[model samples]
Every structure is written in structure tokens, then in C-alpha cells.
Target: MKNVDIDLNLLVALDVLLAEGSVTAAAQRLGLSISAMSRTLARLRAATGDPLLVRAGRGMVPTPRAEELREHVHILTRDAQAVLRPQMNKLDVDALDLTFTIRVSEAFMAFLSAVVVAAVSKTAPGVCLRFAPKPDKDAGPLRDGVIDLEIGVIGTTAPEIRTRFLFNDRLVGLVRTGHWLLAAGDVIRPETYAACYHIAVSKDGNTVGPIDAALHALGLERLIKVVVPGFPDAMRIARQSDLVALVPQSCVGNHQTPDHDAMSGLASFDLPVVIPDFKISAMWHPRRDADPAHKWLRDTVMDICRAAYLQR
Candidate 1:
């Protein structure tokens, strides 16, 4: 058995030597003695079995073999430097082409999809955002790398997952323009609001939530005549029928243009009973905490959410 010696430093020296075409200049460029560089060149010639450089009258010239390896050696060295260097430089969003999978609720996406898409298009035209449904807050997709981001209230997440608060959201009631609730009075009391048939929105088919508990505490309960899988469906039902749909304020949007507003043609009213405002956050795996693209995505989302919050 023969031992094979591998030295990566020789590649760097060879790249400098081929570029400068002089042992003395290569040594000066690499901060090494000329004698040391000469010995390094001898080692490179013996290793590659090629006279990489030869005398050209007053100066040195790269041999055909050296020229062949020049471009390859330069690329390898540059790639190595990029790989080892810290990514502290500014990101080139325009040139970045990437697809990011985000697990988000249909309601939030419906409210902010247009704005988010427009923002990404203006800044990172080549980046694509793939929004997936948030069936449950398991946070498994983030840990498995199946999704780059999970946007919603933090729940049942891994201990190591990173989360950034986006905004605070609370439940709001939605009804049709000529609904009897609006005709009832300026303020719909708990009993009056509860008396109306309600459309319960639950992804997991559970018809009960904090609203129910609050009503129960007051010895009043709303009639949940219909159950839907998501907020969008609830809103649709509330628009056509006389059912009341309770959804997040963010789902209806704080200040959306009429064309982009999800609450268009529908009336949004504050819930009669108090429901605690929950913090909406963007969650990601700890492994992506330092990724430049992931950071940009998070920051962009944060900015959008901040703008929405400010409008409120």
C-alpha cells in the first residue's frame, strides 16, 4: 500500500503561480519566501508530472498544461473561499432564485397574499413563494425541512424552533350587508349576538373554541348551526346566509384596498364577548436561523405584518 499525500494549500499556490506566471511574484502575493515558493512549484510539478511554468526570455510563462489548469484552479480556490467565508455581505435578492415553502392559514393568506406577492415581486423577482395549508400547528414540517416557514399563532412547536412575533390578532364577527344583526342596534349584546345562528370555523372539525368558553362563562351560548374547515368558507357562508362567522381581525385585514379586501361585500363587527388577542408569529427551524434567504423572508414578512399592525 502506498500513502497518497493531499495538500489543499498547493492548489492555492498553484492558482497564484499560474495567474502571476512568476515564482517571485507568486511568493510575494502569497506572503511566502521566493525559495519556499520555488520548492512549492517543484512539489506541484512532481505531483502533476508537468512543467507548469517555463522561462520566457526575461520572465516566466505558463505551459500549456498550466494554462489548462489555470481556470480550473482559480475556480476551485474561489469556491473554497466562498464556502469558508462568513456570509456577512449584503444579499443580492435580485439575482437569488429560490422557492420557499410556507405553511400558513388560508385566512391569513387570503388577506395578505396580494400584498406579499407584490412585495416579493418588487424586491426579489426571481424568488417564488409556495404557500401550504396549515392543517395543524404540529411544527413537524419545519423540523423536517418540508416547509421553510410556519405563520400563525405558536403552538406545539419543537423546543429549538425559532419564532418572531408578527402581530396581535383577535376574533371578529362577519355578516352580510343587510344581515339582521346590523339592523338590531349599534352594539349587539352577547345574548343578541349569541342568538343568531353561527358558522364555526375549525380546521380539525372541532366546533368549540375560546368564544364558546366565554359565552359559557356568561351562561350564554351561541348556536353553531354550521361548521367549516377554514375561515374563508365561514365567511362565504356568512355572506350568503344569516349565519355569523367569527374570524381573526387579520383575516379581514385592518386596512386593505377595496379590491384586495377579503371583507368586501361583508360587514365586520367586534365580537360582543371579549376574546384575548393572540400573537401571530412566524416560526422556523433553528437550523435556518442564520440562512440569508430565510432571514430575508422572515424580515419581509415582519415588515408586512408591521405595516398591517400600524394601520390598525
Candidate 2:
């Protein structure tokens, strides 16, 4: 067998042929005459060293080799189209209409929604933001270009994705005011903390976390009576029960209501145990790292997070 070279144009022709499964239909799709498309297919077959398409009754049938390359040809054509499309940076923000899908934690969305919406609207009125739930730190979506941005701790990010630290957050304990734990003392000691029933937020359903690691180091472990999926659920449980909740201090800031009395029911305290502070970051595919619109969006988020943390 001899090595053969293939061109992108032929790849596109092959993709259309595979999809339509007929030379005439492929020609129509590619806006070319049937003879031109047939010639292209012949070239493609020669280049690939395979009889890619063979006549089968009324329509063309893909040979085994062609069938194997069908999906790859389509993927290459789509990627090429994306690359050949007019550069986003060259378009005017006011005239550009595009949607960006962001995967973020509920806590981050609740706190940053207003700021993010305002920032984008001010410069790019035509742009739309689609907020998606980030139940796990999977980088596959980002790598495949399905997710435009990911906001959370940087632990699960892929090595190739570009990441910028948004801010650092420390775990703090929250409890309902007038709770026995608070009434009993001005400062929470490790022993007193370990004795209280706690609500744990484990989206992945894991019992151990940074807080647990810290407690282990101190020779103490809080008894988690309830394990929930999110911080909001833990807060809800903490509001009505004597159970203590360990959460990011920033996560609870946006939930503060207007009623002073209602606000007074919850109190946040620093954990007595030593734990490493986690840095939250915004991550995106490297292909979009240099895009001006994406850059602006990322910078706006970083700025808002910085300001929000400073205000707290």
C-alpha cells in the first residue's frame, strides 16, 4: 500500500456524500453539479486508496472503509467550518448576536447573576447568557466546545484549559441564631463543634471534604446528621433545625434578606479547625482564551468576584 494525501475540500465532499448516500443528493447539498461532485468523490476515493462508495441497487452504498471514515469526515468538516467562520473579534459587539453557555455552581450564579447580566448588557446587548448547572467538575464539555465557561474550584479542570483564579473562599460554619451552641458560648471550640449535629453539602454524595480533613487533623470530627446536594439545601435545613452547616462564607452572602429579624436568625462563624483555603477560578477552552468577547466576559466576572469579596 502507498501513502496518500487528502485535502480539506475533499473531506467536506466525502462528509456530504456519506450523509446523503447519493451523488446527486451530495451535489445538491454542496451546491455543486452532480458531475463535479462525482469527480470530487472519485478524487477522494483515489486519495484514500479505497473504493469509498459502490453502487447498491438504487442508491450509493458506502464501502466498509468509507463507513469507518464517515463520522471522522463529518467532524473534520464541522471543525473546519468553525475555523473558517468570520472571526468573532472582527464583529461589532452591538451587532453581534451570540449565546454563551456557562456552567457554574448554584452559589456562584446566585451571587454573580446580577453583576454578570449587567456587565454583558452594557457592552453587548445582543449577547445572551445561558446558565447551566455544574453538578460535577467535568472538563469534557469545555474541551468539546459545548460549554463556553466553567466557574468553580480549579481542582477538576483539564490541564489544557486556561484558568484564572477568581477568588479564595474559606469554609465557615453557619447556625441558626438562639441555637444552643451559640447560647452556650461566645466562641466555638473544637469539642463543642464536634458535638453538634451537622448538615453536610456533598453534591457528589461524598462524606469527606476539606472541612473533614481539617477536623481529622485536629483529632475531631463533626457528626453529619444529614447529607444534601447543595449549600442552599444545607442552609434550609440549618434554618429550621439545631444542626450546624459548614459552607463557604460567600455562598450565603446573597441569601441575606431585607428583614433584619429574619437575617438575625443565621450567624456565620470561622471554623476552629485549620483547613487549606480553596481558590475558585473561571476556566475556558484555550481556543477561546484569545477571543475578545470571551476575554471581556471572563474579565468582567473576575472583577465582579474580586469586588464582591472585597465588599464582604
Candidate 3:
């Protein structure tokens, strides 16, 4: 049978025609003209490779093949109707047993993971959030369904990818306690900052960034002594040595958290150079936009991140 080309509308028509056993009756039921119904029946027969209906005296009767298909076709048509029906897809959070993978930067993940897990555990106990390091801003994972969400500064991505602003993040300087730059005070002058050796954070290991450009604009530059793949690594290196780490505010843990206490020896100061704050966003593929469970997960994360920012 050449049924590969058959569409949902054709399946629906087949169900009605098989049940009614009359072309005129089926046409009226489907709100189509008698001639249009006849044409549809012809197409269905051609596609099914069967004489689905034939005249018996003055009325029509279903063939053996049609009788066999009638029940299955009706069930399929009804299921299609239910799936395409316009209604709120209500989700039972407690019953959901799906694991969603989120691609995120190590810095943000460090601060966000515990709180996000706590929240999700309280509400949807069965759901799991797997955090994967984002090596770069590649939208391929979301497109291929390898990841359900992405959290980071949104950059060049597919135009169709959906993004929502989570919070604004600004660059901050991290230095070890009693560092020479902070010997005078918490505020370091541009020249003093420029004199210090720096640790640059780049997932792809590119050394120069916004801070470099800002410094060069004033004919001042900081020597980048080391390049790290993540902000956490930069923070660690900064804590143990005199090398300065420049990181986003989001990378700093909440003041109330033990994570923050762990960084008590490292002081965070505003950058002497002017670097504009960038928006950290939640990005996902459009295919999951209207999915109830996915929407719940997005909203949950958005709310948590917003509250976390407020606390910071």
C-alpha cells in the first residue's frame, strides 16, 4: 500500500467514511461537498491499495480491508485530535521522572547548583538536573536535544533559539588577602591594577578580553601571566598567589552561603577599568518552548536566579 503519503486529514476522512458507509453522509459529517468527498475517497483508495467502499444496491458497503482498518483508523484519528487540542498541558511534577541536562559555565554552576537542586528536590523529587561544562557558546547541543537548557552570557547563536534574561553581571577583580594592590585600601587605581600580573578566564583559552580592551583604550595594559578554562580555576589560582583574577559578579557565591565563606581570604573589588555589565540569560531550543515540564523547569530556574541576584 502507498500509505506513506497519507496525512492526518485523510485518516480522519477514512474514519468517517468507513463508519457512515455513504459518501453523502460522510461529506455532511466532515463539512465537505459530495464531489470533494468522492475525490478524497478515491485518493484514500489509491493510497490504501484497496476498494475501501463499493455500491451494494442503492447504498454503499465497506470492503474486508476497510472493515479491518475502521477501528484502528478511528482510534488514531481520535488520538490525533486529543494531541492537537488547544488546552493547558498540566504537568504532575511529583510524577515526572525525567532528567534534564543543562549546559552551563563552571562559575555559575558552582554557585547555582546547590540551591537549584534543593529547590527542585522539594518540588519535583523525581526530576534530576545534570550540569555539563559549557566549553563554548555552541547552540548545537540544544538543537540536537543533548541539553535541555543553557545558562551563560548569550552570544552568537541560532536565530531561532529562545533566550530569557536572568540577571545582569559585571566584572569584578579578585585578589588574595593583604595583596599589594589592597595594601592602601579596597579601591585600586587603574595604574596599580595595570601593574599586577593577571589570570585570564576563557573556556577556549583566549587570553585577551574586555578588560584588556578597556585598558588598551587608555594606553594601559595588564600582563596576563596565565590563562584558565573556567572562572573557578582562576579564582583558585588567585587565592593561592598574587596573580589577579577578573570574574563576573555571578561567579561570587552568595554572602550567606558557606561557598562565600570559603572565599573570605580573597577580596572582591570593582574593576578600575570600565567594562559594561552583560546579561546572563537562559537559552533553549524553540522545540521545547511549549512543553509543560520544560516550561516549569525554566520558570523555576529563572525565579531562583532572580532571587539569588537580589540576595547578592
Return the TM-score for each candidate structure. 0.70, 0.71, 0.69
Give the distance in Å from residue 248's predicted Cα in candidate 3 to where it truly belongs.
Answer: 1.2
- Cα RMSD for predicted model 2: 9.5
lDDT of 2 by residue, 164-225 (tens): 88877777788887788877667878888988999988867787887777778878887989
- Measured with C-alpha atoms, the lDDT of residue 199 in candidate 2 is 95
Quote the positional error of residue 29 for candidate 2 in Å.
Answer: 25
Judge candidate 1 at residue 293 and give its lDDT: 79
Count clashing pairs, candidate 3: 0
Better of 1 and 3 by TM-score: 1
TM-score of 1: 0.70
lDDT per model, in order?
0.84, 0.79, 0.84
lDDT of 3 at 88: 51
lDDT of candidate model 1 versus the reference: 0.84
Question: Cα RMSDs of all predictions?
Answer: 17.1, 9.5, 15.9
Colliding residue pairs in candidate 2: none
lDDT of 1 at 235: 85
lDDT score for candidate 2 against the true structure: 0.79
